[model samples]
Target: LLDGVRGWLMAGAEPLQRLAAMPTQLWRDVSESTRSRSDLENEIALLDQENLLLKGQMQTFWSLQEENRRLRAALNAAQPLEQDLLLAEAIPVKGDARRQFVLVNRGSRDGVFVGQAALVAEGLLGQVLHVGPRTAEILLLSDDTHAVPVRIARTGQRAIAQGTGNGERMEILYLPSNADVKEGDVLVTSGLGGIFPPGYPVATVSAIAEAAGGDFARVSARPLAPVDDVREVLLLWMRDTVSADLPKTDHAP
Candidate 1:
């Protein structure tokens, strides 16, 4: 062991002695080693940071997938109700010149047809204008051509609620000047037209104006149901009962 140690010292020290490296060279090597180690540590930290970011993205992906699955399940559960009605989705909005209508994801294939009543949970939105194999257009209650015979929910004072394209409101026309309707009066479908059902909340009197020149009181009402927020609506397919099937269209006797 002693001989081996002496031989190693002689051989090892000879190269250093011949090279004549200064103290500064040794310090430089040590500093370079420290710097290389620091660079390696920095690279490792960067890789760790990249890995954390990737993990966070993966977590977000999974969360969105879970949320989508939950929504799909809820939509499926809304099917198969025992009521004489069909559920349909309003999936398209056509805002074009010469054609202003909405298309629904229901049609003859889904047992929907023309003249069927389309109603939201709040109230009526429209009726089926044209139905195809898997889709239909709904003439929204706000359309200028749409008309609904409505009555005062309080006084039963009958009047025709006409769509004026004036958003969120229905124009109750042909009311008598001395009518008892006031602001905030509730208006509902009388089912007198044989189109809409009775007791469905349609709109509320937002403004009551009595123009002196106009013989009729202009009673404008805001729709209780949201026209733009219509997502899912129910179609009334049940045939009316004996009393409702009478020849007299007016429900108010």
Candidate 2:
């Protein structure tokens, strides 16, 4: 019995000795894994911060580029030296489903008034609808309610070009069914109404069709003017008393 007892005691001590040696190796592996995880987390955070910084920088660069272009164009157009021509920067776009509108920096104090004509980089925009002290509202050529006197540039046939409340669509009322006008014909201001100048382009004929039993051809117009992409406009100075009288409002106060 004594011999059997001693053998069992030796067996128990051997296992305890092995267990004491194992903890150091296990702790070393755990520390290494923890360090690896910490490094990966830090790298991910750095990348996220870098991406945000780059996006902000890109936005600033593009904004500066657009502003530079606008100022350069304004400088060139301002060189004509008319005593009364006022150049205004377009500030905001007021989008309506049936009409297009823009707000310019000039207003009544700057001689901008309702019914005063406004032109963009390409061509005619529309007449001034509402004027304020520091800002003015411009009605675009695409409004359903606004109409302009126009002529077929190729044939000199006078007609009224009216807006259709959509992109590049308008109407001409008095063109005869057999008029020399056809698709792809260009239309310009006729200067008959005395609102627009004689040489500025207005639109192009996109389609021509006869109404049911009507004497006139229903002509569709696509405006040559840049109505949607305007960032600045030129306000013409009127020396003629007639143009001064054309403004809808006389009292600025």
Candidate 3:
């Protein structure tokens, strides 16, 4: 009887020990699985972040490509003389945030001179005011002292477009109250003043306000050139015929 009882106790103890060890083994397996899952999640997050950055870079590249294409088309349409065309890089002017002035990489050594016309992809920027051996300053159309002789594309009515010292717009002075000009009318260089080439785009009329008792209409226009954001310009050397036709004055202003 004693032997049988000892055998029974031994058997029961073996089963109890196995049960305790089973729980430990289960805990170890669960911990290992959790760690593997955590590592996978971290890797996925890193890949997503990299993808977003790549998308942004692609967008920037396409935008620059489109801008260059437009610039090329405008250059071809202008049909500037090969000998007269001087491609110039823009140099920002300090303290002229109003887009009143800009500098270029061309100068007297590059065949650029004072009073030469500076054009961008869209339209005229200004005349070269000062020249250096390797740099030149441009007087933007938004300068208060600057003026361009412009005519209405529809009616051939001539008017003086003057800068308002603001980057976004200019003004036309001394228009008769009953003038044929209207909003959305296109303005171009009239060839009356030799500073700008004739038939070049300048500005578009934006608003017209006439006082009840005033004799002249108050006219405002938006400049065609992007003076605040232009990066390149064309320095056109006027043909001999055009240069001789110019009057003694450099510009109207």
Candidate 4:
């Protein structure tokens, strides 16, 4: 009887011991799971940071690529020109709508002078209005006070293109009501004023309004050169005879 009782006691004590050990085992498992989750969260945060860094780098890469393309295009445009060309970086001058102009790195020290013509890859941009020691100011063709003599490429019709203070539009003045002008006609510099070179694209005819009895037609044109967006310019040194009659003034006309 005593032996059977001892066996029962042993079985009961074994179960109690296993129950006491279960809490410790469960705590250890929970600690391991928590550690694994913490590690996973830390890894995720690190990846996010890396992703942002790469995105920023990509933006810089795209910007550099665009700048390189622009420089190459400008160089190609300068190669075929017969005139002496100087490449200069243009900096925009803000404020004062009446004085719409840009300053270039080239100046009097670099042989830049008043009345020098400035061009972009597309076409004529403007004329140099003032020259300093290290910088020169160029008067944009879109300034209200600016004007250029132009001829219609299709019909050889001559007229004066005056700026409307808007970068995208200009007015063709003194065309007869019966003039052979139409939309999409290209207007090029006639070189009559002696400030700009001949045959360079100036503007394109966009619209025309003619009055029944008026002698002149109201013509609107869009400038060929991106006057507001140009970042680089080519300064041309024309023959002395061409620029000899150019007027020197604080403001260009």
RMSD to the true structure for each prediction, in A, is: 11.3, 10.8, 9.8, 8.7
What tens digits encode model 2's per-residue C-alpha lDDT throughout 153-196?
Answer: 89999889998777578888688877898899988778787767
Provide the lowest-lDDT 10-residue window in model 4. Answer: 244-253
Q: All candidates' TM-scores?
A: 0.60, 0.61, 0.64, 0.64
**How high is the CA lDDT of each candidate model?**
0.73, 0.75, 0.78, 0.81
Clash number for candidate 1: 0
The sequence of per-residue lDDT tens digits that candidate 3 reaches over residues 69-182 is 755755654435432455778876676655477888877667667888888878778888999978988898888978999888888888888998887999987677788988
| lDDT (10s digit) by residue, model 4, range 60-133 | 99987875675455445432444556678877667576677889887766778898888887777889999997
- Candidate 1's C-alpha runs over 4 A off are 1-83, 97-100, 240-253
Clashes of 3: 0
Worst 10 residues of 2 by lDDT: 74-83
| Stretches of model 3 off by over 4 angstroms after superposition | 1-72, 75-83, 97-99, 241-253
The digit string of per-residue lDDT tens for model 1 on 3-31 reads 99999999999988857866778889999
Best by lDDT: 4
Candidate 1 least-lDDT 10 residues: 244-253
Clashes of each: 0, 0, 0, 0
